[model samples]
Target: MTMEKLIRFAALAFFSIAPMAVATAQDSADYHVTVTLNWTEAAFPVGFPEDPHFSRFIGMTHNERFTLFADGQTASTGLGLVATNGRVSILKAELGEMTRRKRIGSVVEADALKAGAGVVQMTATLTSAHNRFSFATMVAPSPDWITGASGIVLNPDGPWLESLTLPLWVWDAGVDGGQTFTSPDDPLPVKESVRLAATPYFLHPAGLLPIGTVVFVRVR
Candidate 1:
């Protein structure tokens, strides 16, 4: 078979076996992690917990392996996932708490939230083998505009691979005119215009915010 097909088949096989693989290696796994974050959006009719504002982010980070956002590039794949699905979810987990919750994605189109911006919940999932893996999703409002790694399974990080997977977010794939969000003409984050061609990467912890964004991918 072709190389691309081979890779896809191999990934499916690995996922099929992942249950046992995970059980056996649960303890020895390189990283054991849990992420929890809360967000508030003025776009919502109310406030935190009850108000149900803007968006949410659900992703995973491995030992310096992956990130929801890419760097050097602009924008995020997560956001693209939102607009396409029109709905997603971000699950909040508490260590040993046995409780999980989901929330909405972003609303970059909202006029009220345009100036104030929006708040987003975040969760992350990471793998020990590759820098890529399928990411989680959050759904609430329509026009979903944020998401994280999805079915991500990158090959082991060599010095070069490690160097690439630094802080970053998701972006529209241009599959459906990526940069065409909200309007037919210029996209909101005009600076991100170049990002329409490929997936973006940013090393900033706060993600792309306040315009004039900078993307840096760092390994930790």
Candidate 2:
């Protein structure tokens, strides 16, 4: 074949294959995450109740279209259930709905923490379209307290991060009026926006205590 013709064919082939290669590279990635709870009595001694535990960890990979929960935003009914009662079914259903709408890529759930200090590991898959991770787990024995991260970007500028460690802070779902860890079920007169837990129950001389840390490591 002529050199010009061969070069033209090569150019066409390269263009066709380049897009597929890029797509495959950015299509999806898997990550192994370790959630370490440190809500020990020694770390947070003020009114630390007995049998401190955490509800099952639940999360999802989503894009800008969805958010599990955010500070200053009203908690959805599903999130309210998780915060108030440690129930995950409703929130899982909500995530399913978003998946059907193509707003999410995957839903991840992990074992609950039966003690104040422990670790739960989970694997999550993220897609190029849904590269953000959001998760929550209730701080049991509390009225509507939870600890989790929201809308953490795993792939910020086209490359997935190798690893990340995030500090988990206590948050109030704003669905209950209780002030203590073991406070009875008391629905707020008016539902308020979610915010960091600031009641005396979570406050300390050094500022609010972090409940845990979540570490994400990309495996593939």
Candidate 3:
């Protein structure tokens, strides 16, 4: 075979299961790949506003870089930011799975998702190894949630990663545990909870908090 033809074949065969001829090597090579992902949302029964409820969005960011909770360690700052925002209840994910791959883009498709609702439709497209891949997730008996079949793409020369979003449960900084939502005048506006003057607020958990959810990885 001529040098030009051999180069062309190598470019097209990166993900191929075909055996390679070690003797016939090329100067430089590149490959392409893609992926399609689907996601859904589900919330534990928090009930009506008169009974208030909450949910979460578990995502694997570009290259799956880092994660919040470790097996025996504490949650970090980035994750803490998410948790604070989700006040009522939400899993703050750090990140995980920082691969050699790049982030082309991701998509989130859904009709509508209610706070306490179980399901919301979503989909994503990812590019890797000069090719494209797709997957979806679906939870049974719940329109509020759905996940597609995951098409995994692993690298013989790449990395492994994981990240997650956990369930939401009510929390109140202990100093003012019994405080209700209200208005207070100061240099800054009063936030979510009411004031119990002359007291300090601390971490105090309430309600049924959710367990951690896993972020699935795709191997090419």
Off by over 4 Å in 2: 1-15
Q: In model 2, which range of ten residues has the least summed lDDT?
A: 200-209
Give the per-residue lDDT digits (tens) of candidate 1, residues 62-141: 33322333433343443344444433331222201211221112111211122223333222223343333333333223
> Evaluated with lDDT, which candidate comes out highest?
2
Q: Mind giving the per-residue lDDT tens digits that candidate 3 earns over 84-189?
A: 3322122221122123334312323233223333434333333333122222221211211222212233332333222222232222212212232221212112
What is candidate 2's TM-score against the reference? 0.91
Tens digits of per-residue lDDT, candidate 2, 109-178, equal 9988899999999899998888999899999999998999899998887789999999999999999999
Q: What is the C-alpha lDDT of each candidate?
A: 0.32, 0.90, 0.28
In model 3, how large is the Cα lDDT of residue 193? 27
The root-mean-square deviation over C-alpha atoms between each candidate and the true structure, in angstroms, is 16.2, 2.4, 12.7
lDDT of 1: 0.32
lDDT of 3 at 217: 36
Candidate 1: worst-modelled 10 consecutive residues by lDDT: 95-104
Candidate 3 residues lying further than 4 Å off, grouped into runs, are 1-58, 61-65, 87-113, 124-220
Per-candidate TM equals 0.29, 0.91, 0.30
Cα deviation in Å at residue 13, candidate 1? 33
